[model samples]
Target: MDRQPRQSPDFLEALSARSQDIFRRLVERYLETGDPVGSRALSKMLDMQLSPASVRNVMADLEELGLIAAPHTSAGRAPTQEGLRFFVDAMLEVGTMDETERDQIARTVSGGARGGRVEDLLNEASALLSGLSHGAGMVIAAKSDMMLKHVEFVRLDPERAMAILVGQDGQVENRIIDLPPGLTASALTQASNFLARHIVGKTLKEARQSIRRQSERQRAELDEIAQRLVESGLASMIEAETSTPTLIVRGRANLIDDAMASDDLARVRQLFDEIETQKGLLELLDDAETAQGVRIFIGSENKLFSLSGSSVVLSPYKDANDKVIGILGVIGPTRLNYARIVPVVDYTAHVVSRLISKKGEL
Candidate 1:
């Protein structure tokens, strides 16, 4: 059964020190073994003079407060989603990555140090995170604010033409647009020249605004067939580039481990469905872009993973100007090793941001 809704922070603070200690031990034990923790098990781990019966009484209180639950009639108690959230926020101590982990991350990100594309760097980082965390790794590629270096139009058919945009960063993008009827090849060449003159050294958004203003004031001068082609071509290319952020995911196979497949196949299937329909994931990443540092979403805390009992740890990576550009994260079961994974994610974000800042130099 799903856990109860989250209680207020006041509820956590109201617990006695002894009760809090017991709760922390219980949650930690469950996270380690993926099973419920009995009072006998918790008593042995505690330092106080609490017997098994005393521990049982505390566990009972924790249960009534909706912090933990017994999965079966005779089984030990496990922390609910609310309990896990409390443990993560109040009791968890985040640790730094070891030398080996640092070296591995660095190697993965800089493998193409001889000058790789930004897309390649992000893909490598995602794959590395997936391998290290044993969870699905996700990355949103940074949006281009690249200035146009050149623009060309090539007619393919009677009604279609290809718009080739070369950016100042050496990145090339292409889009196909519908040609205005009764337009000649000479008109296409004029349209390409007009766009190149106006948009070179300007970002796509800047070019769009400039075109809009020119269209409004110089309507008579731009009444030719080439002007219509320029307007339609630029509009289509800008919309295609800025419509939605690109999402890259790796290590989805890790989500369906033998234990998950056998014990909770339905939840696994649901998780797969959630990944397939990535609107929820994109929205979650967008929310992370607004926040600083690592953002953790445990189970029902975010509605996207409410039924799947999943967790996501996301961090926003920035550019040279310290603007948040994209997000990267790991997704897995709620019992992921937050202490270890949090530092890995935080470090990876730092590395990615530095790489982005150096994109022009590369």
Candidate 2:
């Protein structure tokens, strides 16, 4: 379970100049119109000296190069996944966002900062993203350090006690730890005093390390019962936080538009189902945005999306300390305009990082 994403393959010298031109046209046309590309149409658009028959020959050659496919006998060709990959990797030219779009995105993403909580910011960002992209937008909020605000212990049973930990950031965690065999109310008081002395103003890891060192010193008057309680309680608290997955997604309904009209309707339904079930969207984004940067998963190359005929453009958003907090991205049909959306997603992630930093400063 190495969590890092697999690296992308290096580009090889494969398609010739003419074949590249044909592939680019088919990909561009498919993305723009969501339709197949006929050779006659391409010949007229490119103003090449080739007839329909000659253009068809070149298209066949391009198909042999794994760059194009004819969906039916009489229909025009469409860019295959391999062809789309080639275009995305080398040929596609992304147009710059107009000033209007840039300002709009900035305003939209920053709207959730009224109170400046990370959760609120992420929710606003997800909703704004969905609105902007006309597809699903997702944000995986990263867990931050808990600044301790308070702690209390409740005796749930003679053999169990619950540690209620509250953080300055307004998050709460409750962990149940087994009581020592001979533990009593007096022992609980002594344990709370001993533990609070070590836990306050320190992170869970820091507290654990400090407690471990203190217990190992084995002072003669040390409260053995209290030390064991603190140790078990700390371990349980850490495990509880790690096991909880926090993810936010919006705009799934946006996918049911005309762009997804392929023979894979059932498959699309399954993909939507997966998105709503397990944290599939987060998992896919986590797997792709590996280098602390943006990554594009096109068509069959992404296992989660193989049957869905979809593409995911993901970017890693960082926290104030410059650590990758989570990933953000758009998911849509494979014919999506990767050229346009890649830069948009990348810029959006950057904006999110900047906004988080600003909010932290506040």
* TM-score of every prediction relative to native: 0.83, 0.78
Q: Runs in model 2 with CA error above 4 Å?
A: 1-16, 72-74, 151-165, 172-201, 210-229, 243-245, 257-260, 273-292
Q: What lDDT would each prediction earn against the true structure?
A: 0.79, 0.71
lDDT of 1 by residue, 1-362 (tens): 11122344655667999999999988888877777888898999999988999999999999998899998775699988878888887788788677888888987888744454667778888988898889888887555666788989999999999999887766787889999999898888878877888888898779878878874565454547888888788788877776656778889888888336438767767877766676565576567666768878898777767778788887888888888778888888888888778888888888888887887533
Q: State the displacement of the C-alpha of residue 291, model 2, in Å, after optimal TM-score superposition.
A: 1.9
Candidate 1 stretches greater than 4 Å from native: 1-8, 72-74, 112-114, 150-164, 174-200, 209-223, 258-262, 280-282, 360-362
Worst 10 residues of 1 by lDDT: 1-10
Deviation of model 1 at 210, angstroms = 5.2
Q: What is the lDDT of residue 257 in candidate 2?
A: 61
In candidate 1, the residue pairs with backbone N, CA or C atoms under 3 Å apart (3 or more residues apart, or in different chains) clash, namely none
Q: Write the per-residue lDDT of candidate 2 for residues 261-300, one digit (tens) a residue.
A: 5555676686776665644544653554455556778777
